[model samples]
Target: MSSDQSSNKKKNNFTIIKDDSTDGHGGYGAGTISLENMSSIIVDPNEDKAYVDMAAMHARSDVERRVKWINDREEVQGGKLYWIVWVTVDKNENGPYYAGVAGSEIRVNREIKRAYKSMAEHVKHMEKSLKGHIIVEHMDDHSKKLLGDFLRDYKPELWENSTEELTRQLF
Candidate 1:
């Protein structure tokens, strides 16, 4: 393909999620934009997941609850529901980056990483030095992966060598 096509492809990495309001029952439905100027759809508590929607599973309550209740409903990877909310961030007429999907794990991973970094900094300052080391424990493999995937998925600039591996198993 041409260089422009290649660039577009690279920018298409993020999955866009807009606001969805029809997920009041089974928690899944089509999307309709409420605002005109908005470029994406947003996912709400009572709405279903959809392309262009910025969706969140309440982490502890909503996501776990729904993923279980609708076990394997949209099964993709080994009977597990796989929902990919797509978004188009067109850079051509719009700007430089356009059309993509936003990985929720990415957002979550950043959040945890920020928290971890902050905690680590606080500890080092309080203890007078980070001579020992830094690490995040207590979480399970799944939780770690959830955050790891986000890091590896979106924040590639922040990942490298052992850092990626450490965070993969830790955050």
Candidate 2:
């Protein structure tokens, strides 16, 4: 499109405003996305306490293990799912493709406003998928508790971005 048309498109509808610091190759850094949006912390596969606990639980009797599995799975599915919607300069493109967990909600319109709040021009070509569904497996109480603790203490940034209702449900 012509320069005039491009400018008009931005003015008429929402478009990504590039962040001056963005390196143009997905270098937006972990800072741009809120902590709530992160699906999980990367635990040490071998030495993590949560991993050790989960392994023990998975070996239990069938019925007992099944119940625990279902409850744990619901934690993420029931909470607000988030992703980054990368919109290209060309409006005709199908994406702004998604890059996050499996169950991220695909509805575009619902999250547009929320996404704009944290958006930067470097990512203007892409929109943040603020609302969506995420697919994750069951984790044990130890895992959940560890994560909750991290959020409550180490990663408090998400607290302000999250709604009280979401905080209760997630944490």
Candidate 3:
């Protein structure tokens, strides 16, 4: 595909808020959190780029697929840093916006086939994002900019509708 087509396809991987699965019926799945609004954004600081990678939702993104996970960060010395950002979209009176954004860190050493990431932290961040919290303060400036630019360029309307907090932190 052409560059524009490729870009569009990458952008299309992001998930937008959808109708409630429970639909106010309050039945079997009522209390469960709906993930339709969430998308996983992978930020690769080494490459200075970010993109939505839906496989990341299941810990199967390209950067993560072949590595063996290690519990200790020290074990992954010289590993490249990456961020899996959970971005949740929601609609307001004005339009759809990025209502939640939380970044979780991961370090990978491709040559050694080793990676370090806290599953607990990732789960917590996901929950926090689902609740509309912004938790990207831990990310580096470059990765933050990459994420911000990706979000803005992928869908300008959503970025424009996002809160000042998102803009202020990302920019």
Candidate 4:
């Protein structure tokens, strides 16, 4: 095979075709993007596991409470459920990097799987005196609303009950 054909074969082996209609180009355009090349899709399990550990290390009571609150609400709606929300902390950053609520442990695991690189980079910008730490925060009302909005927009299928149904049931 020619070098160009070999390169094409290698590229084709790694990525699946993506439909980018909702991605602002109208639909299938002249050129397509590859999902595998996306920064978020970390392929190495070991690297991902490391990030999950980093996330767990900072799991605080309040964070647990937040996870519980949402999990409780979802469970009441019935069927198997496992959901988690995480925050990534850095020494210099002013705000918590809310990892977002994940529907499953695996999904949550993926969020942190490739975090070490960025976390390490953040450390380089930190002062010598302050120590960096990671911790999980309980979802406050705002965070809860954010999660609700995200689920509605991105993962509506996860919700068996609508907000109206939930409010009616709870209240």
Candidate 5:
């Protein structure tokens, strides 16, 4: 596509925008064909507590033992099935995607929004308490996008870009 066409394309539809601080390799990070709501938080595996906790839960059930633990308070808050969605991101293309899903609902979209806020605080605590751990909680729609906008809105400088593996999972 010509430069004009490319710019026009971006204007017509939502596209993932990546800051080329690290490198221009964030191909899809440049933008995506899908709608913004369909975007996802491309997490850094190194910081993926979900992947780590699954390994720990097998041997021990302690919260300390688990890489990521659902808040007991939140778990018992909404309903019998309450799950929280957690995501991690890096500043560049190199990342490991980690997300946590809980079946619990806090009720209404507002509650879900608050739930995300609480989760963000929880993740900040996790990052501080756990050494060398990078954790972030961003809200993504069912398609997992503004997890991109969130990243952009929150940190325009830290662009992790998108991963092919993460995109493939969407299909």
Candidate 6:
């Protein structure tokens, strides 16, 4: 395969949903959080689109590439806003669903090679999503719609099985 294809394959691997690591085994990795069910969604309001970009799981999404991170949001003036949403899937009595969904804000300015995002907020959102919390209410309407459409189109069944709160908030 060509270099681009090989790189794409590697990027795709980040989105694979794995089986629970603990699985009630009570040994080795027991009591620890399992990220197997989680995926990252990158929402770009400027593009009016949302899509899964697993590399964001490590702050390496395409928009984040080649940028130095700045803690002070003011430093990244004119930076474009982006949302890194952490979505966790789990199966209930009905079926597999979007159990947890949280969106974190990020701003990037490629021209200045700087980006702004709170590491603490991102970490907190990821943890909340793992615990089945929905925290996208703070996102702008356009971004929310994009996220809702992406989720529904990505997996109709999952969207159907998700809680009404998710649909209500996103819509």
Instruction: Provide the lDDT at 13 for model 5.
Output: 27
Per-residue lDDT of 89-124 in model 5, one digit per residue for the tens? 333444423222111122112233222124455344
lDDT for position 47 in model 1:
31
In model 3, what are the clashing residue pairs, if there are any? Answer: none
CA lDDT scores, all candidates in order: 0.31, 0.29, 0.91, 0.27, 0.30, 0.89
Error of 3 at 105 (Å): 0.3
lDDT of 1: 0.31
Tens-place lDDT digits, model 3, residues 88-109: 9989998999999999999999
Local error of candidate 3 at residue 55 (angstroms): 0.4
Displacement of residue 55 (Cα, Å) in model 2 is 23
User: Which ranges of candidate 1 are over 4 A from the true structure?
Assistant: 1-134, 161-171
Tens-digit per-residue lDDT, 45-142, candidate 4: 22221112122222322122233222223223422212232222222133322221221121222222211122232222121101222111322333
User: In model 2, which regions exceed 4 Å deviation?
Assistant: 1-40, 44-131, 134-137
lDDT of 2: 0.29
Winner on TM-score between 2 and 6 is 6
TM-score, one value per model: 0.23, 0.26, 0.88, 0.19, 0.22, 0.85
Q: Model 4 off-target regions past 4 Å?
A: 1-138, 161-171
Candidate 4 collision pairs: 48-113, 62-138, 63-138
Clashes of 2: 18
Q: What C-alpha RMSD separates each model from the true structure?
A: 16.7, 21.1, 2.6, 20.7, 16.5, 4.6
**By descending lDDT, how would the candidates be arranged?**
3, 6, 1, 5, 2, 4
The residue ranges of model 3 lying beyond 4 angstroms of the native Cα positions read: 1-12, 16-30
Winning candidate number (TM-score): 3
lDDT for 40 in candidate 2 is 21
